[model samples]
Target: MDLQQLRYVVAVAETRNFTRAAERCLVVQSSLSHRIANLERELGVKLFARSSRRVELTSAGEAFLVGARECLTAADRAVADAAAATGVVRGTLAVGVIVTTAAVDVPEVLQRYRARHPDVRVLLRAGGSDELAAAVRRGDLDIAFLGLPEGARPPGVETLALDRDEHVLVVPTGHRLAGAARVTLLDIADETFVDFVAGTPARAQSDQAFAAAGLARDVAYEAGVAELITRLVARDLGVALLPSAFVRPLAAGDPELALVPVADGPRRVEYLAWGRFNPSPATRAMLDVLGVRGADPED
Candidate 1:
């Protein structure tokens, strides 16, 4: 019935627990519970099926949440638009990125955005390209930086290809192929590999390349973070194929590793992705800071 009550319902639905939802909304647990109960009574529908161990949304809650989120988005946009008309940008800018993004310096960009619009709140999240792209489409993230295999782009969102880099082989300094100027898939087919977790976009980059060559690789170690993969390679666990730009800095670390170009390695394209229409003022400001627009090429 009210925006505050709607917010309480949404928070509870997202967190799936009264206590955590209250913590997120900066309220006491009992108050949050009472508000949601009052709203449920007003609507004459049970929104959540509550249990001591967990909270699950009823069928009604799932339907209600979609509208609730839209209402909040509209309300927030109205306020932000009003501020923008007066030449001030005020809103939350949620950005998502992959761990291996190398197109732009994220920290530096955030610093500049903060300095330019101190009134705006900035949020950053890290995830796989597919997940981040989905977040952008869902309006959960205002913008995202993604890395996908060559010629691939995130669907249902506006995207700009920022940079393209080939994957390079990462090996211990004393490894056999470390001295090689370049290698191909056939050359490394028998070598043990360290790679991203299976089914992830990062992992798929290499998987697609090898599959095209009709070769199979032995991925002995899997990690979510590129830094961890480099550490594993440094310890002689296995060599890895990773984006050259992402691997360069990791290879320069304490237990240094070597990078050899993979002649037939996968190429990854870094992209800036955002919702296709009516981005918030803060989101627009960020795009301006990045020197790009949704209408740019590859949109």
Candidate 2:
């Protein structure tokens, strides 16, 4: 009738003695006998033949015993599975990242996370900031690495500032300004700029930085990939202002391209974003692994 009743039946069948079954069940003999009687009555079948000396199973009892044992076994397995799911911390974690961000930091972070939580499966998706934001909003991604555009926060998402990286100007070795110790926005105002596509967070940041410095960047070309933009700079097509990390990998590739730090500059703040409604334990664990301390929930 119920799991306990099924367990009691199986215990009785195994022991073949009411007193011994009750002892094994850690229940009083009379109470155990009463529960068995109730189960037999509900089923309208005698489950056991009892005597003063011994107890034996009826034909119906033998048939019912097998089914009862199976039910108890299945119930135990279900409980074990539920506990494993809730407590073992093993599941697929879907993470989104901007292509530039992934190129810079994600590989190292993923390696560390895998080392720490080997049982947890990691799935990574790369896209632009807007696409990553949309994926988090749609619940397709558990968390994402995003640069807030123009300091505008995404609605219904929480963020933790990871690190601020200063933008550096990339110029070809033959270019005159490449020899400068530090280039200012005004210093490179005359040169054409290769930048990220319009509407991207990096572009917006570049525009704001130039605007704040009261200078206009001559737009020569636009490309989304950081590597491509660096290549363009290497070719002397135009100079570009990009995150320092993005330019680090390009340093060894092109001896002509110089990644110079921008003096008197605005640094880009990178944040980890996640849905505020209901964050998964795995997501929280990932933030912890990334050393991201979330904002106060009360705030």
Candidate 3:
């Protein structure tokens, strides 16, 4: 009936509990219940089926929830637009970044953004490239920095090439292979390797490199985070294939770690992804700061 009633229904649908929804909405449980009841009465349909132990949405409620959430999102965007018109970018921007990128430049990016627009709020989450891509597609992330799969394009998001990071071999400085100028895949095929988990873009690139060299790797360990893999290699657990940026900080501080270039390998490409439709002005500004632009004039 009204925005307030719709807000109450949406909150209850999300939390699936009257008390918890009321708490999140910053209202008393009794008031929230009254509002929801009035809304259901006006609509002549039950939104939620309730019992002493739990609650569940009715079929109609499940269908209505999507529209309710969209309405609230549009309302919030409208407010954000008005604020931007007054030279203030004030809204929550959810950003997702891969593990390595988060460590490399994300902190500096956020610091610059905060200094420029203190009113804008940012929520940063870290995950693997696949997970971050899924969040961007699901509208959970306003933008993301992730490795795009080879020949894979996101459904409703625009992609811009950010930067390329070369794959390299990471080992303890005292290891025999550490002195090599450029190591080929065959050189380490028999060595115990720390590998990225399968089904990720990084793994795909690494696999392609091995396949190109007419070799196969013996993976002794697998990890999700590059820094963790580096730590394992530092402890002499196993050598790892990692991006150049991921090894920079550790190589600077720890003299025992050696990063050797992998010759004749495919470079890892990082992409800046944002929803194609309904991107906020604040998001565009951040992209400008990230130095992403349209295709080069020569192209």
Candidate 4:
């Protein structure tokens, strides 16, 4: 009923646990639970299904959370507007990034952005392009770095192309093609493949390339993170196609992993994407500090 109770509901919905949500909200577990219980009693609907193992949102919780998030977003915007009137920028800048940005200069940009606006807190989230872009579209994230095909980006999002990197073939050092000067999709078509889970930008681009070359690939295993894919390759489980900047840097640490040029493989463009009318003051400041180039996305 109250704003604080709504905040508690939103936090618990996001974290899926009372203790962790209470910690994030800077309150004790019992107090947060008491507030939520009071709200549930007043509403006369169960928000969450409590279990010893995990918490799941009930039907009412799912419906309540959507409105709760919008209310909080509106309140946040009002507070930000008032702060801006006094030339004060203080808020959280929620950012998302794909795994490959480990090679990019994101840290430098964030450090510099914080130097200019010390009161703004930066929170980073990591996921594949599809997940991160979805979060940006839903206003869960203010901005994100993602690998995407050049053709289409998500709706309600503006994009700034940062850099494009080619995909490379990853093989264990002992694989015969590891020493080859050039490799093609045809050469690896029949080999067992290790790939990212479906819907990731890397997987999409790789699939496109294989299809364009008129070949079918056998994906033997799928992993969520780059490290797992490389480890599978190193163990000779299967070969994989990955971003050059993402898997290439592992050469120094993993001597068994060999990164080879994919010889005209697909190139994935990295982008900084945000809501078209994103109004976060800290987000605007971060954009200025990064000086990332942008143009209106084609519909």
Candidate 5:
């Protein structure tokens, strides 16, 4: 019925706990519960299935949440529009970033944008490429840095390609293929690998490349960071395929690590993306300050 009730519903749906949702909305649990109960009574349908173990949304709640989130996004955009009308870039800018060098210089872009438009408020969130992309699509983030499939465009969004990273094979100094000039997935198919955690961009790319070559790799250990992956390689745990930039600094610092290029390697392209419609004022300022082409030029 009201924005407060809608917000309570959304928070509860997202957190799946009334207490945490209330805390996030800066309200007491009882008040939030009462508001949601009133909303359900007015609508004459049960929204959440309550239990000792968990909170589950009912069919009605699931259907309502879709429209509820859109309502909230529209309300927030209205506020952002009002702020922009003052001809000064002000109000919140929610930005999400993924981990990698191939992505645009997030820190640099924020720094310059803030220097130019001190009135703008910036909020930063970090996560994997897929998670950030989902947040952007849900209107939870104003813009995000993401590592997408090479040349793949996200639906209903405008993307700016920043840079690309090439995958390379890393080995230990005393390893048999350490001195090899270049190799392919087939060349290293027999060797055990120290790999990225399953479902990560690097791991997915590695798996896809090997699958294309009709090779099955043996993963001896799995790590999530470049540092750990290189540390395992230094111990001769296994060889791995990582972004060239990730392997570069670590290989330079550790004499035990050898970097060999992957011929015809899989590459990941990094992008800065935003919704095609109704981007906030602060988001626009950031695009301009970074010289990034956004969804609209006349805004």
Candidate 6:
């Protein structure tokens, strides 16, 4: 019925527990319970089915949640728009990134953005490129940095290609293939590899290349982080094909690791993606900080 009641309902739904929701909302448990009870009585429908162990959203609640979130988003955006008119930006900016991205220095960019707009709250999340792109499309993220295979763009959003570079083969210093001038996929076809998880965009870069070469590799280990993959390679557990930008600095730091050029390697493209529709002022400011003023949200 009111914004307060809606907030309480959303909080409870997200936390799935009354006590935690109350704590998150910075309200006492009894007060939050009373407000939700009043709202249910007014609507003549139970929004939640409450049990001692957990609180579950009922069918009616599920339907209400969709509109409730939209209403809250609109309200917040209205306030932010009003503030923007007075030369101030105030809103939450949710950014998603992949762990292996090396095109843009994320922390430094965030620090600069924070310095310019201290009023805007920033939330950062780490995920696979595909997952982060989906979050941006779903309005869960305001912007995202993704590292996808060459020529593959994330669908349903506006994107800007940041960087494109080929992959390199990483090996342990003592390995036979280390210090090689250059190696092709055929050279490493029989060697065990440590690579990103199968089906991920990061993994696809190498997978597509090997498939095109008519070669199959044995991936001995699957790790999400590039650093972990490099660690496994350093121990001589396996060799890996990684983005040149990410592997270069890593090999420089670790004496046990060596970088070998891949003559026929897959290329990875880094992208900056955001929603195509009306962007919040905070999103615009972030784009400006990234040197993309009036960035076209179109492909």
Q: Best by TM-score, which number?
A: 6
Query: Could you tell me the C-alpha RMSD of candidate 6 in Å?
Result: 1.3
Ranking by lDDT: 6, 1, 4, 5, 3, 2
Task: Give TM per candidate.
Answer: 0.92, 0.65, 0.86, 0.85, 0.78, 0.96
The sequence of per-residue lDDT tens digits that candidate 6 reaches over residues 1-299 is: 88888899999999999999999999999999999999999999999999889799999999999999999989889999999999999999999999988999999999999999999999999989999999999999999999988889999988998888999999999999887999999999999999999999999999999999999999989999999999999888999999999789878889999989999999988999988888899999999999877756443
CA-lDDT, candidates in order: 0.92, 0.78, 0.79, 0.84, 0.81, 0.93
Candidate 5 residue runs with Cα over 4 Å from true position: 49-56, 90-92, 115-140, 148-156, 179-187, 197-201, 207-227, 294-299
In what order do the candidates fall by TM-score, top score first?
6, 1, 3, 4, 5, 2
Residue 220, candidate 2: Cα error in Å is: 1.9
- Model 3 score (lDDT): 0.79
Cα lDDT tens digits for candidate 4, 1-299:
88899999999998999999999999999999999999999999999999997988999999999999899888877887778679888878999988777436788888888888898878999888888888988888999998876565666788777777888888999999989887888888999999988766768888888888888889989888888888889999999888788776687688898877878687787888887775588777777776752445441
Higher-ranked by TM-score: 1 or 2: 1
- Residue 182 displacement in candidate 2 (angstroms): 2.1
Question: What residue pairs clash in candidate 1, if any at all?
Answer: none
lDDT of 3 by residue, 26-72 (tens): 99999999988988888899989999989899998988788888888
Per-candidate alpha-carbon RMSD to the true structure: 2.1, 17.3, 2.9, 3.2, 3.9, 1.3
Q: How many residue pairs clash in each candidate?
A: 0, 1, 0, 0, 0, 0
lDDT of 6: 0.93
Model 4 TM-score is 0.85
Lowest lDDT block of 10, candidate 3: 290-299
Tens-digit lDDT string for candidate 5 (134-252): 78887788898877656555565677777778888889999988899888788889998998788876577788778877889899899867688888988988998877865687688
Which of the two, 3 or 4, has more lDDT? 4
- Global fold similarity of model 6 (TM-score): 0.96
